[model samples]
Target: MSFTLPTPTAAERNRLARLFAQIASDAGTRVMEVYESNFETRTKADYSPVSDADERAEEVILARLEQDLPGIPVLAEERASREGVGGQIWDAFILVDPVDGTKEFIQRKGDFTVNIALICGGYTVAGAVFAPARREMYLGGGAAEVFEGFLPGETVTQGQKLVTRAYPPEGLTAITSASHLDERTKAFLAARKIAGQTAIGSSLKFCWVAAGKADVYPRWGPTMEWDTAAGHAVLNAAGGVVTQPDGAPFVYGKGGEGFRNGPFIAWGREPV
Candidate 1:
């Protein structure tokens, strides 16, 4: 129930990022292989869909995290649900969403991603998201400023550093969840002055905003801590912000809500 927290030194952070990127990329590959095959989907207790890909990918990532990081605790989506980690508090831990955007993955939308993050002091220190179907991977936070490129491997370098563009002078460009869009989101956009919008699935919205492809992503519906932690870190590393409606920084470790997130906005710039 207790362990020494890893020091967040620069070298240590880089090592962690490399290990995490490899894990994410491997997990993503597993997901894509499943995507290419005839996969079955089953409904979970929460009525959300789960597939063989989710379990297989999480098992791969979890085993690596456990073997490599030893004492560091991990709060992965599939395992945590059965282990009840969502209801416990930890000073530092790894949060993993082995497959985000399951609905998109099931639908073959190619919007799903494999997410892994290090959360310390209620903030994500580093994170990585790999979209195998899209052949793209993003890593950010801590010593690694946000970056995007193919997943790190034998040939590719780390990646190009990512920076969110300045709020467009013309107007704001927003991206919303392709499948989860609701009236509240539309109303939020209507009330605000925005020029255009894009609908994409999964945590890719956060990556788009972080990569300067969009300005803001407002989510008024429910999400879990695992759903946003990795993407939140990527956005933050690229000079973006994710905050509650009241504009406070969105921190994790929400044991009270069982790690479920309330509505929040991921902005390319600090909201005025």
Candidate 2:
């Protein structure tokens, strides 16, 4: 017997977006609780940092997801690295980064976020990202339109619609990582004649670009699928594009490649 994936109806997609917003918000609250306390931090095997907030927030997210959407496989950052996700030919699955900026969280910077994305057919169908510290959340993809605001307890219908701005003729405004800026990134900006650059943390860069607050985000460093999926969905819905340096569409479900993402550029508007 062969198994098949069920396609989500429009109503289901809208409902799923709301559920994802709630779940990501719940995870963000857990992170914020740890952020306010004397939390312990440690280095992972990959030399990247992980804090109590990361683990605890993921726990909260996984628990709720399991309860609310049973049988759906979840590829979460901490859990997937610890216990490998089984090789199931899933047509739909959840990708989550419970705490996307552990370093920023540890440093008391309000730039960390909680991310939840639903990938089906190798594309992000629905997603929600919450920055509890900033009281901002972004939701989009699938049947939902891109939107952002105080969205933890609110639905997409209540949030403000987001759209990308036109590319300015003077130069481009770029957002980059606050802690992980590499020379390649600097060179990319220099070559593009960037008008300005802002250093930020987590998937907020993608959200800012989606909301027309910024013009572009160029990432030259390595990243995981969970690190960008949710934001990618939001940006994609907001009239933006995330593509490789060669202008190929950024895609997901690269389990064969260890779910690693190559360098990509997210554009607020099509660039010449």
Candidate 3:
């Protein structure tokens, strides 16, 4: 028999956001442990890099999720790599990327992050992202207002509410992937009057726009649902919108396509 999971209430969503932040932060600690050491890296079947940091961090997140939310299905990177996530349409589930920017982590660029997001009805309902090396954490969804915090130590410092900035009269500033910029993305930007552009690693591109540090992030390259979900949730909560190149909705849970994501543009505010 098939069962659909119910969406969390507003208060429950806020609690889950807090829980997810802590989970991501805890996993980030494991990630930092490997980052500080002489870590060994290996390539996955898909040719993407994976490291001890990724495995260790994923272990932390999986353990916590199993303890707290046992019934909900989890689609995590490391585990999914080992055992393919068979075709199943879930009404609600968790997406976890123990280390979102593995390349950055391997290169010691300090832009990698631990991501965890709750997806309900093919939409991100709550999420958390923790960049351990950068000492920053962001959380949003449901009743909880989008906010960012610093984690120089064990606990997160006070969180400051976040809101996407209005599109400036000046030309737009775009954030693109440092490692994955492609011809299509270049052409997309070329067609616009952009004031500046910044290339960085990981889902932080979405957070950049969410924090109003940049105006838009357009990606024509490939991505996984897990790679974008948490950042998408945070951006959505911050008054931003992520949609297709033509401004259609971008929904998740594409099991048939192996959970891959197509090109999408993230805007701080929809252009008038």
The model with the greatest lDDT is 3
Cα lDDT tens digits for candidate 1, 1-272:
12225447645555666677788877877787789999899987778899989998999999888888888878889887666653688888889998999999999988898899888889887788888888788877553344344642323256778888999878999999887888888888998879899999889899999898999999997798889988887888788999987899888988878888989999998884
Q: Could you tell me the lDDT of residue 215 within candidate 2?
A: 91
- Which pairs of residues collide in candidate 3? none
Please write out the lDDT profile of model 2 over residues 1-272, one tens digit for every residue: 01234556545655676678888777776787788899888888778889888898899889988898888889999988687655445688899999998788888988989999888877776788888888888877543344434634443345667788898778888999887789888888888877878879999999999887789999989899999998887887788889998898888888777888999999997854
In terms of TM-score, the best-performing candidate is 3
Candidate 3 per-residue lDDT, tens place, 119-229, comes to: 999988788888889987887775324334455235543367878998888889999999888999999999998999998999888888988899999999889999999
CA lDDT of every candidate: 0.82, 0.81, 0.85
Ranking by TM-score: 3, 1, 2
lDDT of 3 at 47: 96
Q: Which model is ahead, 2 or 3, in terms of TM-score?
A: 3
Instruction: List clash counts for every candidate, in order.
Output: 0, 0, 0
What is the lDDT, from 0 to 100, of the residue 117 in candidate 1? 86
Name the candidate, 1 or 3, with the larger lDDT value. Answer: 3
* TM-scores for the candidates: 0.92, 0.89, 0.93
Worst ten in a row by lDDT for model 3: 143-152
